[model samples]
Target chain A: MLPNRSRTSVLVFLLPPLLLYCAAVLFPILQSLFLSFFSWNGISDMEFVGLDNYVRMLTADDIFWRSFFNALLYLAICLVLQLGGALVVASLLTSLRRGRELIKTLYLLPAVISTVAIAFLFVRIYSIDPVGLLNQLLHWIGLGTFERAWLSDVNTVLAAVSAPEAGGSPGCTCSSSTPR
Target chain B: MKKLFRAAAVAAAAALALSACGGVGAASDPANVSPTGEIKPREISWLLSRPADGAVINIMKKLADDYAKDHPGFALNLITTPDRPSYIQKLETLAAANKLPELFDTDATPFAQQLAKQGKMVDAEKLLKSLDVYDDYRPGALDYQRFDDGSLYMIPFQFELEFIWYNKALLEKAGVTVPKSLDDLPAMCTALRSAGITPIAIDGQDQWPLERYVAYQPFRAAGPEFVQKLKKGEATFTDPAGQKTVKWMAELGKAKCFQDGFSAQGYSDAQNQFTSGQAAMYNIGTWELPSLATDKLNSEVRDDIDFFTLPTTDGSVTSANEFVSPSGIGMAVNSKTYDPLVSDFLKFALAKYPAEYAATGALSPTTTVQTTVPANATPLYKKALETADTLGAKQAMPWDTQLDPTTNGRLQQELVLLVQGNITPEQFTSTMDNTIKQNAPKFFK
Candidate 1:
């Protein structure tokens, strides 16, 4: 129902941003998809390999499958912690009368902190030689026998790396889910 | 509406087609220099991958400043990326776009070989020869920078010998003598562990440190030829040399040689473990001599620090003197930037570098230049430099710089699993062989 002049103005305003988006995002994705059909070392001349790269990735590359499964596990963990935990936290926050602001601020702290700093913090927490916080806590609680290098153990490394990512920003979800 | 949709689809298709046709422009022809051309002073850049505080960078900075004082309007810009992995990514990306700086650090890997093949790098041999300093370099140092076909394209600056630094007090307390042969290592580890000492500290987080262990046994068992052939898919991991290496790695794991959770430990963490008297032994190169052979270390452990050369194997083809003695990463000059000014600056720098580098109680890559032991340096430091003179003909080339990137990465991962007892030696061999078979042809050809 808008006048033709207004519609033209809106289109004109949107055109620059749309072009920029295509150049920055869409172009790279399409380029990668196109380049995937060739064998290239970046510097050398690329050889056309058709679907060889895909075939190799799907069948011959064991690391690919390992990474694929690890990604799935990461997704599941994030869903449980972010979605399910956020619902529970949101409910608890709604009932709070005092210090609600402080709780929310504290929960949002990790989201504001740089990822490098957070990674360093988690590394210290998982360190084994000098005894990290996790191991120290286990020892103090009379569970010293269970104390192991969390980050180095294959059984626990996935969970160890995943915990920070999934649990770090549950506050964002919690805040969104909570009613004003 | 249908017309608009059709237009959009066609535009998208056209964009994709245009992008597919787009290619990186070829590098310009190399700069030509007249014999008597004026050496104009200008800014030059070096993309580096060394520690900012390390002896190499310190000496280079001083030299650059001294040169700048004489050449008005001259500036030497050093772009340093201390972290290895990040530096490699940056280097490769720049190289792909043919935007490499005046000079850049590189390993003599297949990738560097490709660069040389494309005439992107200046011929270092010719440059050095023209400057009359070619004969001054140590043969081993120069050899380390040569391609598989013995083509020299990069210049070496630092020479180092890797050694197993041990704590004398810890060895005496554990009642274990220094291992005389490669096979004696596992037993020595067990004896140290029995006496409540962590046997060896390793920086497994970086993976290359553990990869060094994988190279040692093969070097001792079959000499350097094994890796040279193995990297090209001419030899399999099932070969005797490879079998020895894999089994030795497994044995080291079984004996509990490295500290618990060593795979997660970083460079600084492992160094701290040894320096604090928690670990009995550490394997590192002479580049660490400043901390290891000086009072800079913890006073309690400083006096106890001593080192031994790599041990020999029974009936070993390689000599005891032949081990992991590397000249560090080499610097390649961009052919496109090889002007008269760059040539003049290099001639001045290369002449002054050796004497200045040696004065810091570190080994230099030139045979003609001798290190002047620093006043504060311990006797151990002098002893290490003297040992470098009697080094053998063969050296254990680090596998990290030898194999293609894909195979090398898989090997590093598989090595961790092998040493962790997660995978048997047989499984390790099979997996590695398959990886080399698949990836080696792409690089080697």
Candidate 2:
């Protein structure tokens, strides 16, 4: 099943893909790395200012740091809810005997919807006047006073945006065929 | 032998894939131009930011339909994005790929300026001059979209001016008259609040309105040059003009002049609040005219709506006649257009757009489009038409359009935080000043 061949054969076979990958992905990344050292508006000529961009981002850009922390928080939530929660749900579904397929399909609806549609849906769900669905649910449960503008409030905006990703978690039901 | 042959084929396939990247068609070609110098019959893709059901979209559709009836072969394929940010992103991505549509629109920002600088956008000044309608546009209408070198690249469409719209009945119920000056607004707000009505329903989530609200005092005190000077690092927010504006804005926030949880309220939500009679006043631009005058939801309160120009602030140099007037979204052509018909269609569409837009009760940026409010029109529509004649020469550009992209974005979020009481007024001004200073050398220079 094997042909007698030298090491040169293997090297020749590997070279094309390696070159293509470097040109398409690695080259742009390297270019960005080089450009990061300059102060440029993307259109104008570059002014070399080594490490100043990094320094400005770290020291002066509060929003950048806030976004960075928010991203980390999102990752933590996603790992917990998406991965851990999915495991729990998949196990529970495996134990079910009736209408398991229908429930799985219903839960998977959000994952099928476009992200933009999901975002607009959440915007409606977070509206303050006429009462958004979330607030309405809270009001129905005698927690009317607790209702606040989820998206407008700085305290709640992160949570509001994060809810869509969490809702998109289908709880690993599709992986039910996988053996332990 | 089979394994060796398959490996060889895989390597050959990889080389083919890499080579195909170069074989792709160029976004633009000079060869598309005919030897006769006449525009070839072709369809031009137009990327529009307007909603599918928006007033402007309807007007554009009507014009396109009329143009199609007249021109047999030429056509415009209008593509739209759901929202502004996504629309801008789509344009930017297309630009990166050198696949920009024949015509599109964008905000006045460093991104648009960059496109002009790179010669990716047509010289709008030249095009309008060729069409002999350059002078017909409202004076200072195109000022917002000019580059540092003073080359314009976008053709402005709708002209917008900002003011406060209050329910006449609600104001009367609170025993308050129209405020003659900014100093009177606090008292009016207080009286309305005591009457158990929200004083103002501002779209705080939009951030542009909040920025304009903060700029009112500085713009009045320092005149139009203040913002331009600030952008160039010649002025700081620590100046009296800047401090005065920020202090007044914070005071309004502290007084709870805006509707409860207004910071979280969206544009449509705030508009609904005012129209539904839950709020006394709604502050927005002239673009809201159609909704204010004729929306089905405003049927009950339609008779009660009227506007007052932004009131005079303390130390104001300009009179109350002056307001924030700037060109709305403007169309720009792709400099690397493959089809000459693209330019031809733009020239044809622009000449007819004014009259068509006016028929829909919308204001056209062109001075020639005569506005005639129907005799039986609602009082709100009539009032807007009357105010059009009184638009002062000292029109201030919206803050977002004037400031560089990085500084403008930071200022938008920071202003929202300031109104939320999370930061002091001083902090807000300082942040904006510092952001402008940092970005000046890169953007302004």
Candidate 3:
């Protein structure tokens, strides 16, 4: 029903917002890309160098590379935990009818708590000695062989840190439960 | 015609948004000096890495108020956070946006050094000399805030000396005395366990405490020379002494000496347990004095808190060096600050800052301030001070503070792994080298 002139006016109106967005968000991002090339600290006059930060990070900084791999490992766990947990929980929930709300609520309990609280709770569960609830229960059930300090060591630190999201209790045993 | 009107409205909105990013107000103006050629009545915000409830914050606030009263043109905007990791992230985010507080506190951690290396903080040396009280701080504390090439960046608050805290009651019950050195610790642990009480209560989940434990052993075995060697790359943690410390950590786990969830307890929680007589011994630093003094323990339990220097490891009177971080929290000014006002502020902040600071927390970091400990500050803190006086150096940049960020990050993660038995002791050392090599080859070389 509008005339061609009206449509052109609409385009004109939209142009400002598009321009502003480009200036505010996109512009800074592009600026960072340019700045990353130079070794200048924030205050000094910036001189143009080429891809030095990136190159140094990759080739010269061993710890950076080590942490990056550690981060990648963490990311993989997150993906698996989020999707795998949802799928498994959904399938298990299908088997319940009565008290479905209660069970569902309990399943979602962790989702409602602060991450710090959850981290602490799991630490008690996977303590290194037979003192932890997990070890105590394992002993009671005659599965004491599986006990260890969940957070202290490097091998199981990642698993312990991510276990909460994986539908497992948190904390590493000998158990240095790490990653979280 | 309607479309044209819409376009005009959108343009107006865009213009408004663009302007919003500027001039939050004259309140935040970098200009607008007072009659003294300094900024008039400006409030400088400080971002800090300590909890608001922390003893340091309470003292800093009182001091800021006192300073403000003396200088009407200045005020402090104090922002504090308890979470260390998040605090660093927030600082980084603020940096990216070019918005930082006027002052703040950070540890000798690597990220702080990054801020200096990346040119975020003002050069502290200029301000330090201007303040005139620079030499009055415990000599090494100030140096800890500087970079190796001698660039001053931050103001240190205290000299932290790590050591062992023993429960006199529990040890007495086991008829065991505080170990004169590390060699006696294993025997003490065995005796305490046989007496039906744990020998130590370690907050193991906090990885840095464990790092302090491992790093100290090298110093114990080879004397302070090991610290120099470790810093210079001549020594690796795989050395027999370093392994001894690692094995000690493992043995503690095996001995079942820690509480049910020591790994999960936060820093305060673990210390509180030891103060309450739940654990016989705790290895920690000096900042715990205020908490230990005021803990909700009976006189008997409270009386039991005492300290011993980490014991000798090798035969030659080998005293394990305490993990002493150079100075405490540092103070820095915004570079955009007017020089005179900044200088005046520094002079005032340093002149009486330490005495008042220690008075607030029972920690007298000032050689000038004779801090009176409450009736109950375990004689250990006083004894620890004497030991600190004789430490190798007051100002060497701490390892945790000196390492580049990438290397530091790898160390934190791999350390968690090494202790978990994820890798053998040799592999632990090799992994450290490999990880750093992979991430930052130039710095190591």
- Candidate maximizing DockQ: 1
True contacts kept of each: 0.46, 0.24, 0.19
Name the runs in model 1 displaced over 4 angstroms: A1-5, B1-36
Locate the minimum summed-lDDT window of 10 residues in model 3 chain B.
B26-35
Worst 10 residues of 2 chain A by lDDT: A171-180
The docking category that best describes candidate 2 is incorrect
Error of 2 at B217 (Å): 1.8
Instruction: Pick out the ten consecutive residues of candidate 3 chain A with the lowest summed lDDT.
Output: A171-180
Query: lDDT of each model, Cα atoms only?
Result: 0.88, 0.75, 0.61
Superposition error at A91 for model 2 (Å)? 5.6
Q: What DockQ, between 0 and 1, does each candidate earn?
A: 0.57, 0.22, 0.15
- Residue pairs in clash, model 2: none
Error of 1 at B82 (Å): 1.5
Q: Report the Cα interface RMSD of each model, rounded to 1 decimal.
A: 2.1, 6.5, 7.4
Better model by lDDT, 1 or 2? 1
lDDT by residue (A87-118, candidate 1, tens digit) is 99999999999888888888778888888888
Clashes of 3: 48
Q: Distance (Å) between predicted and true CA of B352, model 1?
A: 1.3
